[model samples]
Target chain A: MSSSSPEQLLAEIRHHCTQSWTLMEVCGGQTHALLRHGIDQLLPAEIHLIHGPGCPVCVTASERIDQALELAARPEVILCSFGDMLRVPGRQGRNLLAVRAEGGDVRVVYSPLDVLAVAQQHPDRLVVFLAVGFETTAPATALLARRALLAGVPNLTLLVCHVRVPPVLHAMLNAPQCQVQGLLAAGNVCAVMGQAEYNALAAEHRRPIVVTGFSAMELLQGILQAVDQLERGAHRVENGYRRAAAEQGNHAAQALIQQVFHPIDCQWRGLGWIPGGGLALREPFASLAVERRVAPPVSAPASPEQAQGCISGLVLQGLARPSACPHFRRPCTPEQPLGAPMVSSEGACAAYYRYQR
Target chain B: MCLAVPGELVSINEHHDPLWRTGDVSFGGVLRQVSLACVPEAQLGDQLLVHVGMALAVLEP
Candidate 1:
């Protein structure tokens, strides 16, 4: 929108887009940035910046939403989750927001703390919070779960859908066609895991792992650094966002996550299975875990319904980009999104539609 | 899973990681991290974006 912008620098970068540099951004927020600002068009097509499966909604398997719906419809269960999960269709056009519309007592709370107040107010209602998100969100959920235990609020229970950030990164690196040379590491995930984890990734993969921010300047600089490293045949961990992130991430939050959840192999939507990639509530908190209480997942994926055909899985896995998807805009607009990635405010395709051509 | 931004210190506790902090960060929702670490000297209303569990960086908001 102005002169002296990153646009001026774009042409120069494009010239160096390299014979083969498969650079991917590992956060869904970054996907929105690349698409929203039309940075995808601004950059050289030779440099493929694929969207990673960092979007929590995009990766949330079908069974989870079914459980949310089932629990929401229960008279005593007051389900709470972030706003994005509402639009995602689980089975038979049903979503948590739909459950709420049907008057099953579903409310949107900005923070996990809000659930605490709801528990305080309702005393008798079995308020089950649908806690879903990545490391950034895990702390709040962990804190609330702890608070529920300490306060002896038998009515308040959290259905943890918290996932880790690093294991997926590891999965991406190990893919067969994984020509990935670098990554714009999610700043927030790094904030929790700290710079320590990336050191191994960078060394193992021999790629520059630039912990990048979501700003225009931050992303531009991050791309430049990533490109620069690849061009020079260097591999290491770099911090594009150093102001808040340190060598050690939030230890207290880490401690909380450790106490509440244990690492387990979870199914990813596109990539299928990544061993030890997800987190589940610990045994001590078995009563709070939704999987423990829910009946067998009745609303499992149907044969024909299984093929949503959003291509978000391929797009997220870096095998395909949003523009390449024939259904990107036609079938999967943000308002009537066909998949979880498009449903969220941070969705890449939605951002591209709103800001990109 | 978590995304973090950086913040400045509003007030700190010599005994605990700062006890209180207040800042309007760029993140969605009324985001606040009640936890603090003493190694990173912070003051009242300093901004920090946190993810998973660590405070990543101070944002220029």
Candidate 2:
């Protein structure tokens, strides 16, 4: 806890709550933490918490999943990725796990570096690590890229689907369906990308953007800060998680990101394409990209379709809650996820299905 | 997902090239090897923001 404890922060939030305000927490980790600790229930009814598209797994474009499924199906290639991404269905109800069931060499690893060992052991096979995350995890992937390059690990390649926060936030604010008045930005993203990018967005949108951590007390403190700004009619970027994040974030990390990757137009599953929304390998490392090395036999990319009656797109845009989805609890439990939101551990629907409901 | 937590830097493995250094970070009792490439100034006993096995920033108490 900082100077103020969780109880004090909650009390201050209650005292400052004079009117109804809709605030969105942009990180799924924070969303789950809030629900887990019953912090949302502790807040005054005047404050509404809207979930944002901060879960990387939930926002991963369906086409990329199709591509991953194709790559994983290759007999000479060993596909590795985070655990949460394995079960998400892509097109025609096929996921990486399904490919694994068919004898595809799919392995779950905690970190990207773990893929290096697999590459070293199986020198004859191509080891492809699926890099999917925001700025918080980009540095790690960037480091891996550099390491693989330095080691001249010809057998190792990366399938990068790294997304940035600013452009996506810009998209949501410009969206007509979005009703968010204030935002609690993901602290770890700020810990890497810095608070400078958020300053302009907060100023343009006239909304308080507070960089927040993923804990009940830290989240409550962040919400309180957002509410205070809303009541005072202030639009500024604030740092509630000052312990780790700074105005000018880790510059070394930024430099590493600059050296390793470049931005490109990226398609989000529900939100569609955002200019400069995704990161691609730089010139020197382009040769180490899985997409560059592997050419699928298919003539065209698979056009994935969203399952009918799944309101995951609406839920991601904050237009509807998880419970509002017809199949949220019925046909779309964690055991059998109908959409990415239900499958991702940090997903809003999964959080609601597990904690809120 | 931009989920990261604070962990204590238990030890630093210095490479001939400083930027390639790494550290063993302990979150509660669980330990993981994290790249110190981002936070080159990070020292032993410093709290770091570990996400996806990379040290993003140093946490000052």
Candidate 3:
């Protein structure tokens, strides 16, 4: 058999799509990649690719954004976070970017550690870092926190939104609307946490979870591997990203994360709280925890303006597709994003908008 | 799993807040982000673990 193109793969999958498969990619990066590469359009109409809330910005609750904004407003605190997270809306439809526009000391940083250094060198400013992302990102925050404490960077604090992938997957599997036969796990997260966590989930759920790289070839491989497992009635964890991920992930990073963070309840945009699917800075590093210092004061914790006309939450939950949203293009463009998915570079809406629109 | 490799910090430049000084780390032809905030002592050419735009450490050369 010759190697398959995404077009070829989609054509073949369409043959079985009508009655059988619903492969969900559990990372927003994959969602962006698929849509940006036009992998979504290349696919046969029969097969479905559901987007997951792997985007740190898309899944982050409004209350957290408010807290970040509040931190940014303080004269001593310069709030730093991933750029896309800056645009995520809060209580009154305000976001970090909006707050920045209003002259708050908000800075966009690539890593949690960068803010730590700022905190260390400045000594005068409180560098309250907005820590976001999943297990793949938690390590950096953990390492940064440890480093800050070691360096006596008392001015730095972490606004942690570091989420866990496995528990969310577990929640999805148990959700009433759950409709997945296989998974394309975000490869970066596995690089930090390893594929071992997935093994137990696979054993329990009897669903194939293919750890995948961002490359198109790796994605194709992951999809094919998941299909093969489903076809063979075999449920297990497989790594299509072997070069970067091992059965045991980055042990050093894991050790850092374990030392600084403990599982806690986190609010997801659509999925709500999954009890222990998120992280909080442990007692030793509690000083770096932003959640402890700030209280989010949103009149209504759940606000509709925060969503606007965007059905991204539904798209993330697999209830709908980006194209399926009525306001996808007319109202939701990347420059003027109506939803968080359009706001972030890793967002499916942004990817689809940039590539397809 | 995309190859999230280690990058080397060359130098930092900032007036008020410090900017990351990590070298251009090639990742499958796409350059990734690493934070230069943690490695306070990282001089030019100090290798660091770069992930999702954050530098995790001053790694082995």
Candidate 4:
């Protein structure tokens, strides 16, 4: 509902940003949109925009990717995943693409539900969908689980790696090295999960949380709102993307998620394990979990970053820029990535390489 | 990845079970069948924010 133009919003941000304030945007899509539009360069020098660990592809544990690779390697298992996840390397630089090159059945799916069709077509094979995303994407997987269960599809299973935003936000703010003063919550996530958790986060951390959209104008408006709050010494949750996100969000989607999944301690690749940061299928839908059918190869104790000379941990924590990494462009190009950030399109490293570089 | 596109609902395929309802949404010139189970009240010509073949929210004008 922001009527202000991008120019007006930028001007307002400039007027209010009297002191240096570091703000982290907790969504990879938002990070890509900001860099794509050059919003970071357009902002005042005092307003530093740092990226958070929002890229689901970037945050997915390497062990999980290894498990996916293992599953895909099986002749009877058809592994399906989002396109961005295919290139992310697990331990020893192994990935799904490499498995596919070795004659493994790895398929890139546009939606999780697409696997149901694959399962239906090949009843002899096990169709496993590697579900990796935040709240915005979890609901779709939830719906898929519900439909598959209702239809009694026996061959379809899910490798659920869905993560939550609020817990990660709490983890980031609680870190000793955390420099983020305010946050621009992903609007798409807010559109589904609502603002209640963000409101609590703002109050607990004494920082403003502005639910922001993906457009350049919406990002600017969110920055202005955050700056306005910071300058006034007030901290609260503000909905800058009111057009799509409501205070309560889509009730039906939330209900579906609640019915199908629950939160549990899950590992983020670079950020380490955050309590209640990941989702797993609830008891009713427990039979749909891939792990229940086939045991995942027990991975070595997961290191923060799989590749040496990759500072993705710092990059994910908003402590270091992607370009600051020693192997950023030289050895870590997208074609030959050293970390998940470089592999994922929504990753900060990818955004920097695509835009700033 | 939380990227979602606002598409216009071109048509809805009603089913006996509301969860089975689907819609054809137009994203610019591209038309794709999207699940309308999330936004059951979505009508024709309504703008919807879709992600992963599912309509997540109805956009307000």
Winner on TM-score (2 vs 3): 2
> Candidate 4, residues A149-224: lDDT per residue as tens digits?
9999999999999999899999989988899999999999999989999989999999999999989888998888
Candidates in order, TM-scores: namely 0.86, 0.96, 0.84, 0.98
Candidate 4 local Cα displacement, residue A294, angstroms:
1.3
Interface RMSD of 2: 1.1
Report the lDDT of model 2 for residue A1: 29
lDDT of every predicted structure (CA atoms): 0.70, 0.87, 0.73, 0.90
Per-candidate clashes, comma-separated: 46, 1, 5, 0
Give the alpha carbon lDDT tens digit for every residue of A84-140 in model 2: 999988855678998999999999998887788899899999898988999888877
Interface RMSD for each candidate model?
Answer: 4.9, 1.1, 6.1, 0.7
Residue by residue across A137-252, what tens digits does model 3's lDDT show?
A: 88777777877777677777787887888888898888877899899998878877888889998998889999987767777778777877887788999988775666677666
Overall local distance difference test of candidate 4: 0.90
- Top of the candidates by lDDT: 4
RMSD of 2: 1.8
Give the C-alpha miss distance for residue A270 in model 2, angstroms. Answer: 0.8
Superior by lDDT: candidate 1 or candidate 4 = 4
True contacts kept of 4: 0.86
Rank candidates by TM-score, best first.
4, 2, 1, 3
lDDT of 3 at A278: 89
